[model samples]
Target: MSVWEFFVWFFWFYIVISCISIFIRVIIDVFRDPELSGWAKALWLLFLVFLPFLGAFIYVIVRGRDMGRRGMTASREAEERIDDDIRSAATSTSAVSDIETAKRLLDSGAVTPAEYDALKAKALRGTA
Candidate 1:
């Protein structure tokens, strides 16, 4: 075989591999995607199988932003949860300190009745 023949075969092989990889990735995304419902997943799979290139490209364009938003939402939620847990643990571990702080804040009118109740409960209970 000539060098041109080898080059053509290599190019064809590369193209096929790329298409297969794209298809697999798209399928996985469709399945694992939280935003997509069961019907949407089915439709996306149908489109991908029938109109592979167009379907994949459209999905990437449409759902890509949602994926980014989901990531941000998850990160923010995780941060908030960690902060809450730390606050709870700290209040429990430092009950006397928390009560002193709450008392000072209440005396200064910086805390509301509900806030005072919650803080006092945590202080008395030594856990919440």
Candidate 2:
């Protein structure tokens, strides 16, 4: 093929890729929009399926701003949940290790039975 033909093919390939990317993003946004009711989501899907280019343009024009907000909110919520899980895991692991150490001390005759019981209670209470 000639250079011009190659360039044309490349341009069309890029356009098709861009269109597909936008279409997928729109579909995801439609589902992510919690404000839309079930019927509304169904209608939107139908519209996009039947009239892809027009539906995409209109959806962007009408609800484009909320899409970014929804994505950011989702990302923030996920991060917060991960942080909470990590914090809980760290505390629980430390509590378990503390109890194990206290048990070892008791076995070695370094602490009395009463002291070991107190330590176990403290660890279980998360005050270790």
Candidate 3:
């Protein structure tokens, strides 16, 4: 075959490969998304895998929610905020969780020894 014919075939082959790869990635992400109910998601994925190009195109247009980046970013930010809040609240709660509280409660007329010991056990257990 002529060199030009080989080059033309190579170019079309490259385009076909690129399109297939992009389609597969989109299909994978469509199934990876957490929004769809598990069974529906699984069936939709089956459709994509079995039906190829048409199913993939239709699935992205109908079911894919523009990839996961936006939702993932929002979830990550919320998780970080919750972690920060947990740390702040934990510091104050920790002060009340030490042996000092247990000892003080025991010495005072408030908690009996059994109650103090139980509370101490709970505090230590919780800390661990």
Candidate 4:
């Protein structure tokens, strides 16, 4: 195809993809909304299914701000869960490794028995 025809096809493709993305987002928001009862969700889904453009436009106009807020809250919650996982893994690994290193130091006479005991206790307490 000519370059102009290619550009036109590309433009249409992008528009279609954008619309689908927005539609999916709307659907997700509808379900994610705690205030919306099951019947309300069903009605919104039906409206969007039968009159996509108008339904999507009205949904956005009516609830766009709340949609954005819900998205941010979800993102924050996900980040917090990831951070908690990382912290748990780090603390567990560090405590074990720290105790191992202290044992090695004691065996090598680099640390006295008392120091090794203290290190082990600290590690077990998660303060190492």
Model 2, global lDDT: 0.93
lDDT leader? 4
TM-score of 3: 0.46
- Clash count for each candidate, listed in order shown: 0, 0, 0, 0
Residue 59 lDDT, candidate 2, scale 0-100 = 94
Candidate 1, residue 77: Cα displacement in angstroms equals 14
* Deviating ranges (above 4 Å) for candidate 1: 65-128
Off by over 4 Å in 2: 2-4, 94-96, 104-110, 118-128
lDDT of each: 0.84, 0.93, 0.76, 0.95
lDDT, candidate 4, 1-128, per-residue tens = 99999999999999999999999999999999999999999999999999999999999999999999999999999999999999988756677888999999999999999999999998889852
Provide the TM-score for each candidate, comma-separated: 0.51, 0.77, 0.46, 0.78
TM-score, candidate 4, is 0.78
Write the residue-wise lDDT of candidate 3 on 1-128 in tens digits.
99999999999999899879867777667656767688877787787778877777787676556665745766799999999999898765663557788888789868998998888888777777
lDDT value, candidate 1, whole model: 0.84
Instruction: Write the residue-wise lDDT of candidate 2 on 1-128 in tens digits.
Output: 99999999999999999999999999999999989999999999999999999999999999999988998999999999999999988756667888999999999999999999999998888852
Rate residue 83 of model 1 by lDDT. 100
**TM-score-sorted candidate list, best first:** 4, 2, 1, 3
